[model samples]
Target: MIEARQLTKRYGDKTAVDGVDFTVRPGAVTGFLGPNGAGKSTTMRMIIGLDAPTAGTVTVNGRRYAEHSAPLHEVGALLEARSIHPGRSAFDHLMVLAHTHGIGRARVTEVIEMTGLQAVARKRAGAFSLGMGQRLGIAAALLGDPQTIMLDEPVNGLDPEGVLWIRTLLTGLAAEGRTVFVSSHLMSEMALVADHLIVVGRGRVLADTTVQELVLQAGGDTVDVTTDDPAGLRRVLTGPGVEISGRPGSEQLSVTGLPARAIGLAAARHGIALFELTARTVSLEEAFMELTKDSVEYHAANTLVGAA
Candidate 1:
């Protein structure tokens, strides 16, 4: 398990990570999600002792990373794949990391096979493609056979096959009761792999909940109704506590605070013909965008409007 308690970091006058608290339990893949410049990399660096926190603390299991007897065996991380020496062979790189902790060649070979890098284990890392480099980095992280694993953007340059391989590998590790924490800005990817999510924005916790719970918190139970007589439907839905939107002449009306069955019954009673009445739940992508819209660092203007 990994825990952060009121953890914060600041550089000069700028605060990179604010006071945040969260726990990543074992036996599941916990996704760390945030936009660029949201301080995800900073927080991960602090957890691994790469950077000092200005306030609070983070722990792997029960001790700080620096306090571990064998830190590499307790926690393994792939913060950036390009951090490896380019001239070294994939096998040689793992061998060097293993040698640091007195680990042997057998373990290195095991990880090479485990990460499917055996085919290019002897190739120079500098010549490897981005996907191959990622595989090599993962191989190094697994060399110690650590109980906790953290990966940052593991699928950034992966093809479909490599992406699936990573998904399976992480899920398998978590199923074995190890703590798996992976960070990514891709909501669709995380939604497929993560059992729980820690959503951050602007260095603060936006949500710490199960994926289902987070979606529910984003008003998941609303239903979208599309009918020819949308205005009439709006009139029928006008009542206290029933929120209705989508203007008259619009093809759809968004209805909330009422069950789908109730909406159908009301439409039936009013002799209204419904083209569509679907219970709509906010997808993980939509929820993420809504939460981080304010924190996104860059935006592109709608060019079509300008052209017109």
Candidate 2:
């Protein structure tokens, strides 16, 4: 597990991270989310001891990351920047990291195969494509078989197959009771993999909760109801705090502020024939946008010019 208490960082007169605190537990994937310039990178750097925190403390397991005798075995990290040497081959890169902790060549070979880099193990790191480079980085992360794994944007340049591969890999690691902390801007992917989330904005933690809770907090789950008498059902369902909308002449009604059970019962009382009713849950992306709407550093104009 990874824990940070009042963790902070500053540069000259600017504060990059501000008294942020969160815990990443084992046996589940925890997603790190934030808008641009929200101090996510700074926080991650502090956790791995790449940058010293100006105040407070962070620990991997029960001690600071640097305090472990075999740091790589305690925690494996793949930060945003590529840390490989351009002159080294894929196999050589993993070998170098493995050598630091006295890891054998067999483990190095295992990771190469695990990441599907066996086809290009001997290729120069500089000549590899972005996806291939990412694979190499992951191979290095798994070299030590650390108890905790942290990755930033692991799917940046991956294809659909590679994306699915990484998703399965992360879940499998968590199932083994390893701490998996992943930071990514891909909300759709995070929604699929992460069980918990730590959302940050403006150098502070905006939310630390589960994916389901956050979505419910943004706005209650929406329900889709289809009835033969749309107009009659709309009138019967309309009430205080309840919202109902549907397309003109359409049999479907989009509803909020009430659950499927309540809607169905209400329709039954009114003798309205229901054709379909589905409880549509709010997505992680929607919740993130609502929670971080005010914290976003940049905004794009809605209208675009010179469109084809």
Candidate 3:
């Protein structure tokens, strides 16, 4: 497990991370989410002792990262930036990292195969594509078979099959009771894999909750209804806290603040035959955008001519 208490970092006069407190527990994949410059990278670096925090504390198991004798066995990390020597072969790179931890060739070969790097294992790291580089980095992180795994954008530039491989790998690792903390931009994939989330913005923690809770907190439940009598059904279902919208002269009406069952019943009471009625839950992507809209540090200018 990883724990942070009031963790903070500052550079000159610019505070990169505020007093942030969170814990990443074992047996589940906890996604670390944030906008750009939200101090996610700084927090991860402090957890692994790459950068010293100006205040507060971070611990990897029960002690600071530097206090561990066998750090490789305690935690494995894949950062956003590639860290391997470009001139070295992928196989050679893993071999060297393994040697640092007293690990052997057998384990190196195992991770090589596990990350699907066999074909390019002998190729120079400089020649690998972005996807291949990501695979190699993951292979190195798994080299020690550590108890905790932290990754940033582990599936960047990966093909569909590679993305699936990463999803399965993360799930399998968490199933083995290891702590998996990852930061990613892929909300769809994170929604599918992560059991919990830690959302941050403006150097402060915005939310630390389950994926389901975040979606529900967005406060909108929608039901789509297509019927022969849109006007009649609209009138029948309209009430306090209920909203209905549709394209003018269209048969489909989108309803809010009403359950699908209620809509169906209302249609029946109005003697209106409903063609289609379905509930649509707010997706994780939509919830994230809504929650973080105010904290976005960089805003793009919309200068399109006559855009509505």
Give all candidates' CA lDDT scores: 0.90, 0.93, 0.92
Pairs of colliding residues, candidate 1: none
* Candidate 2: C-alpha lDDT: 0.93
Expressed as tens digits, the lDDT of each residue in 150-240 for candidate 3 is: 9998999899999999999999999999999999989999999999899999888999999988987874688999998899988999899
Which candidate number has the best TM-score? 1
Of the pair 1 and 2, which is ahead by lDDT?
2
Error of 3 at 18 (Å): 0.8
List the RMSD of every prediction in angstroms.
2.7, 3.6, 3.7
Better lDDT candidate (1, 3)? 3
Cα lDDT for residue 291, candidate 1:
81
Instruction: Report, for all candidates in order, the number of backbone clashes.
Output: 0, 0, 0
Each candidate's TM vs. the true structure? 0.90, 0.88, 0.87
lDDT value for candidate 3? 0.92
Q: List the residue pairs that clash in candidate 3.
A: none
- For model 1, what is the error of residue 95's alpha carbon versus the real structure, in angstroms, after optimal superposition? 0.8
Question: How well does model 1 score by local distance difference test?
Answer: 0.90
lDDT of 1 by residue, 1-308 (tens): 99999999999988889998999999999999988888899999999999999999999998999999788999999998988888899989998888899999999989888888888999889999989999988887787899999999999789999999999999999999999999997788888899999988889999898777887767767899988888888888889878888875688989877888999999999999898888977899888888889988767875785574
